[model samples]
Every structure is written in structure tokens, then in C-alpha cells.
Target: MSWMTLSLTLIFVFIPLLLSKTLNLGLERDTIVAALRSTVQLIAVGFVLKFVFDSEHAVFIMLMVLLMIVAAVQNARHKGKAIKGITWKLFVTFVVIEVLTQTVLLGLHIVPATAQYIISLSGMVIGNSMVLAILFINRFTAEVETHRDESELILSLGGTPKQSINRQLMKSIQASMIPTIESQKTIGLVQLPGMMSGQIIAGADPVQAVQFQLLVVFLLLSTAAMTSVLLGFLSYRSLFTERMQLMKIDVE
Candidate 1:
């Protein structure tokens, strides 16, 4: 079996036993089965990506990239079911990060004006962007939901929606970007990041690979931070109205 398959199987078999024996925690057999299903899905994606990269066909690459974006948005939106305006939040998050990451890559000449370059860069940034979007969406939505009465009070006292939820907005935005910022701060200190270490081990010059990894981190930092803040603002829009009334975005 391929390494990926072998690893997937090992994880499928090992995780539950480890959880039960080491922590006495239970994800249930159903959870373990679901995790294995995800592994199978990823394995399928690996095959599709190989075809996309090798084909160098614009249509194929675009389709693959679009599929990836759909998957990402679905994942991010799923976590924010309480945030009534999930679709809008997802659009803002995806669009902002896509534009920012694309601009950075093209402007910096990190990759050529080709499908391969665009797809690869977007995939990397999108992965980080999804996490950022989910983090901001969940927290911002929950905070607004919890403090909704306070927001109404503030509105009655002459505060705009923007002004009313400013505290929670800032909090969620900050919380979303904390992981990205901390990863940036701690790389090479607390951990040898995957890309850099992998490049070095693959016989590339250590210094050169480190430089490439730095550039990746720089792009991810901007992509993740921008996505979090933009998504948070978009989510805020559905929570309040022009008349400063709380808009009930019923996820159901």
C-alpha cells in the first residue's frame, strides 16, 4: 500500500484505541468511522490534484480549484450555523482571502501567470483562510447572540450597530488571527514548520528553503488575518439592521 493509505489505515485503527486507553475518552465508533471516511475522501482528492497539476490544462485546473473552494466554504460555513448570515460571511471570507493571496503571489512573482501556480498558491492560502473564517464566524456570531440584548440597549442609547458590536467584533477578529500570529512568532523556535523542514530534508539548501517558507508564512499571515476580519464584518451585517434592530438570522 502507498504511504498515504497505510497511514490512513493506521490512524483509522489507532485513534479510537488510543482515545479509550490513554484518555478514556470516547469519540464512539461512529466518529472513528467518519474520520476514516474523511481519509478516503482526501485520498481521492490527492489523485485529483495529481491529475490537475500534471494536465496543465486551464479548464481542469480551474475546476479543481473551484472544487477546493467549495469544500473550504462548506467547512467554514458548517461551523457557524448559529450565525444566521453564513452565506454572506463565507462569500466575504473566500473573496477577500482569494484576492489578497492572488495579489500577493502575482505581485511578488512567487509563481507564473498560469493555472498551476494559481491553484497551488490558492490551495495553501485557502487552507489557512478556512480556519480563520471558521474561528471568526463562530466567535463573532456567538458573541452577538449572547450580548444581543446589550446591543439593543446600546442602540436605544444612540449607538449604531457598528458601534454596538464593536467590542465583540474586535474580540472575534483578534481571536481568529491569534493562531496565525502565534505560529508566525514561534516558527523555528517552538516548531520546525512542515514546508521548511520538508524542503530541507528533500536536499534543498537549508537557507533557500527557509526563505521560501518565510515567504509562504508571510502570505498566509496576510491571507488569514484579512479573511478573519472581513468575515467578521460580513457576519456582523446580518446581526443588525440599519434601524439598529437585531436581525434574527435563523440558521434553521
Candidate 2:
């Protein structure tokens, strides 16, 4: 694509701004901020990726992946601030998801051990897992708040914290994972995902692009399940006090 073509993409941005203005949605500022941030971040990432691709050192790759995980944790931790040690919980959850996904890819030789493949796949893995983690936290917190009485009743009836919150925990995990599952179910028919479309535009064989897209979708599904279940189990306990009573969460 030429500079003109890239510049013309701004029209897409105008649609959102126009709708926000007409509807008085108060999203103009947010839309502009998001567009600007996305532009700047993608440009910076392009440079960093270029340099990493040239270097191809294992240590550099590890450092980059770790940085991505830290960013994911920071982005997700706020959603679960009511829970103690949420940052660590997010960090561990992302690390496990990323490692497991990468291990499968590399161990099975599904993808070549190239910087581009590793970094791109890692972004998808960590990004989806981060979103799932945030969703799980938000849902779990809301469920706990909504069912506080039921939880307390369970506790009063000699139920353990796990038993008291198990329903909410399962509900939260399922809620967070459903979108990923549903999207995958309709992936090919509903839309061409960015990865596949980008590859096809770059002149890759359509069949090859489809194969890669399928792999990514599978990875995302696995990540969605792992992130939700692992974080749900690890985090539900934080909602209870040592005396097995429900802790009051103060929403800011």
C-alpha cells in the first residue's frame, strides 16, 4: 500500500467521529485518542520488530516476550484491584498461557523458529489471554457483588469459601470464554480475520493463509479457556476472608 492509500484509511476514523458527534455519544475524544495511540504504538512496534528480526538472538526474544507479558499484566491488574495480589495473579496466568502456547508451536514444529513468527504468535497469545483475564475479573467481581447475600448464606451454613463462590466462579469463567468460542465457530464465514487478510494482501497463498489463521484460532481458544479457568480458580479465594466470610469489595 502507498502513503496515499494509508492516508485514505482516515475516512474509517471519520465515520466513528461523525457518529459520535451526531449521536452526542461523548466518544469523540476517546476515538481520537485511541486512533492516535494505535498509530504511534504500531509505528514504534514496527521499528522494534524490525530490529529484533535482524538480531534474532534468543535472549532478545525472551526479553521482548517478557515485556509483553508485563504490559498485559499491568493492563489487566486494574480490573481485579479488589483482589489481593492481582498483578501477580495476572502475571502468572499470562506467563503460563504464553509458555504453553509457544511450547506447543515450537515443540511440534508447527511454525519455524523465526523471530517474526514467534513474536507475532506471542502477541496473539498474550493479547487474547490478557483480555480473557480482564473479562474474568470483571465478571467475577460483579457476580460476587450481585450474589453477596447468597455467598454469605453459604458461609453461614458451614460452606467453604470455594464452595460458596464456586457457582460465581464457573459463571464468570464461562461468560469470559463464550465470546471467544462463538467467534471461532463463525470465523471463516463471518469474516476474514486480520492475520489471514493481511497475509493474503501481502501475496501469500490463500490456502496457506487459511491454515495459519486456523492455527491462530485454535491457539486463541486454548488461551481463552486456560486464562479464564486458571485465573478464576486462583482469584475466587481472594473474595473471602480468613474466617470464611465474604469480603466486601469497594468499587471505585
- Name the top lDDT candidate: 2
Candidate 1 yields a Cα-based lDDT of 0.78
Per-model root-mean-square deviation over C-alphas: 3.4, 1.8
Q: Cα lDDT for residue 240, model 1?
A: 61
Q: Per-residue lDDT tens digits of candidate 2, residues 60-145?
A: 89989999999999898888899999999899899988888888999999999989999999999999999898888888999989
What is the number of backbone collisions in each predicted candidate, taken in the order shown? Answer: 0, 0
Model 2 scores what on Cα lDDT? 0.91
Off by over 4 Å in 1: 1-35, 114-116, 247-252
Q: Which parts of model 2 are misplaced by more than 4 Å?
A: 15-28
